[model samples]
Target: MEDRNMKNPLYLQTKMENIRRYSHDALFQFPKKERYLLCRQIEDCIERIIREVIRFQKRYYKKNTLQEIDIELEFLRGLIREAREESYISNGRLADWMGHVDEAGKILGGLLKFYQEKEAGRSGK
Candidate 1:
């Protein structure tokens, strides 16, 4: 059996948590009306990503979940960009948020590669 520590590195989880924290802080700066509009969507996306990340870590079949996380990350990225264009967030804030999303995307890419290789090896054997 894989060690618990090895199975759960918490890297993605930590990154997502940071995103959640930063975004929550930034959302408060948005207009009161936007609190339900764009802000709500962003919050939901982050929560979904965090949930999927946990699910990805636990499941033995990880590829699909990984793809889901990738998709969610992209959606979150788009939403953040939309927020900036709408003037809900500043350019500097957008850059900061994008930095966090990009970091998580890089980590997710590494995991996707590792799993794809492992899956291919199994098929070849």
Candidate 2:
């Protein structure tokens, strides 16, 4: 039998970790005033994304969780944009951050597609 307790070595998790690290490094550049506001939100969103990736692997019904992750990713992207607009992060940082987010988003899109196809197959049966 397959090992249910085994960790999924997906690149999505790595991407999320990278985002967390990068965001932390970037957040330090933010002024003290924004630290507890926009910075906190971005940090929380990154943490949630990491958590949901693990939950998606463990749960039997994952569509909802995936959708949540998708929303969070979008929110994170928006937060990153806000940072850039406020000049908290530079264009280069924004590019790098967006690259990681885009990669993770693509991995998420694939999982969402797979689960959707699975549901369709079940319904068709």
Candidate 3:
């Protein structure tokens, strides 16, 4: 049986698209008073992380790509917590943002594990 739902570079693209959609909608509803500060920070953090992911992929830095994703995942997790603390986002929104983090982490973890196994197999030869 063929696994048609294979994960490739497009998976990362799809994930980034989701982030962009979420942040764009958030910024739209976010008050103008906090526009430049909170709203922009959220967008910037996500966008920069996405950029790093794309760069790593294009350069084929396999292990480094996973590491970058791990780092950015941590960053996003923290941002969610901080936003919650600052009361910029409601509990529902926090949960929603966390959902994305969880999904991304799972995908990144799978990628990292695959590479780690590959490395182990290579070294055992």
Candidate 4:
């Protein structure tokens, strides 16, 4: 069994936890009118990414899961953009949160490369 602490270079567990925390903080202060809209959408986006990251870390695919994860990731990106446009995320706030997301994505890229290599290796290509 792998250690859940810090053996993994990806640091996805911590990233996902940050996502959850950030989203919770973001949503908690949102006005009631936004409860069903931006709040919900941001929550969903963060939650889905967390799920995909967890899945990626646990299961490297023989076939590509990028197509699958990309779908969710795209939605998350759209939600972030939408949040910015809605002013739900102020410029400073967006910068801070997206900066973390960027760092997380870099770590995630390493994991993605691992899966891609594993798939190629399996195919003997």
Candidate 5:
């Protein structure tokens, strides 16, 4: 059978799009003071994650890039939590952001495991 994953190679594309959309909407609701600070940081983190994911796909040695992506993902999650705690975002918005983050995390985790196993097999041979 053909590889289904190859047909839609960018598995995280939809998740990234959801993140970008929600981050903009939720950040727009933040206070003017946070617009330049927390908002910019969140947007930067999201963009970095997207860039890192694309880099991860293009590079042959994805381990380092994946680690960077994982770190950015966690950082993004923390920023979202902070936004919710500071009342910058509502609980409903938090839930929406969390759902997208969780989905991306699951996909990233699976990819990380696959790479790790592949590396191990190569080293063992």
Candidate 6:
């Protein structure tokens, strides 16, 4: 039988691509000191989010993994805000980053809700 997980939509892929592009462009502009610190943190969080999404798709029990993705996304938001306040990124760049992050969060949220409902249904029967 074909793998149902392989047939999953491209939402995760698209979000990962957008985040990688944004981080590449934005991180390059950070101060030398923060380039390794805050910049690295943001990049790591993005990777973690991508990894968690992939795991979520493959696993039967997805709630924990989904929660991890949510936490990583929130961490990213905080890092982006810090970047803006510290003058690492301009208002325009901040807006761009936030837009991408928000899109990813919405997509993940939808997946999370879907799985939650599925889990509830399974328990009900």
Give residue 115's lDDT in candidate 5 (0 to 100).
82
Better of 1 and 3 by lDDT: 1
lDDT of each: 0.88, 0.86, 0.72, 0.66, 0.83, 0.81
Tens-place lDDT digits, model 3, residues 1-125: 11221235557557767977886775676667878877777788788778877876777547887687688778778876877887877889888878877776766776677778788998999
Model 3 is weakest, by summed lDDT over 10 consecutive residues, at 1-10
TM-score for each predicted model, relative to the true structure: 0.91, 0.88, 0.83, 0.75, 0.89, 0.88
lDDT of 1 by residue, 1-125 (tens): 12332234388788899999999999999999999989999999999999999898789899999999999999999999999999988889999999989988888887787788889999999
Off by over 4 Å in 5: 1-9
| RMSD to native, candidate 3 | 2.8
Error of 5 at 115 (Å): 0.4
Alpha-carbon RMSD to native, per candidate: 4.0, 4.8, 2.8, 4.4, 3.0, 4.5
lDDT of 6 by residue, 33-124 (tens): 98888988888888888888778778877789878988999999999999999988889999988998887777777777777788899999
- The digit string of per-residue lDDT tens for model 5 on 1-125 reads 12333223287666787789878888888999999999999999999998988888799998898889889999999999999999888898889889889878877777787788889999999
- Candidate 2's displacement at residue 60, Å, is 0.3
How much is the lDDT of residue 23 in candidate 1?
Answer: 94
Candidate 3 TM-score to native: 0.83
Model 4 misses residue 12 by how many Å?
1.4
| Candidate 4 residue lDDT tens string, 27-80 | 676678988987887787777776765675566451244445556666766777
Task: Rank the candidate models, highest TM-score first.
Answer: 1, 5, 2, 6, 3, 4
Clashes within 3 Å, all models in order: 0, 0, 0, 0, 0, 0
* Poorest 10 consecutive residues by lDDT, candidate 4: 1-10
Best by lDDT: 1
Per-residue alpha-carbon lDDT of model 2 for 19-80, expressed as tens digits? 89988999999999999999999999999999999888788998999899999999999999
Candidate 2 Cα RMSD (Å): 4.8
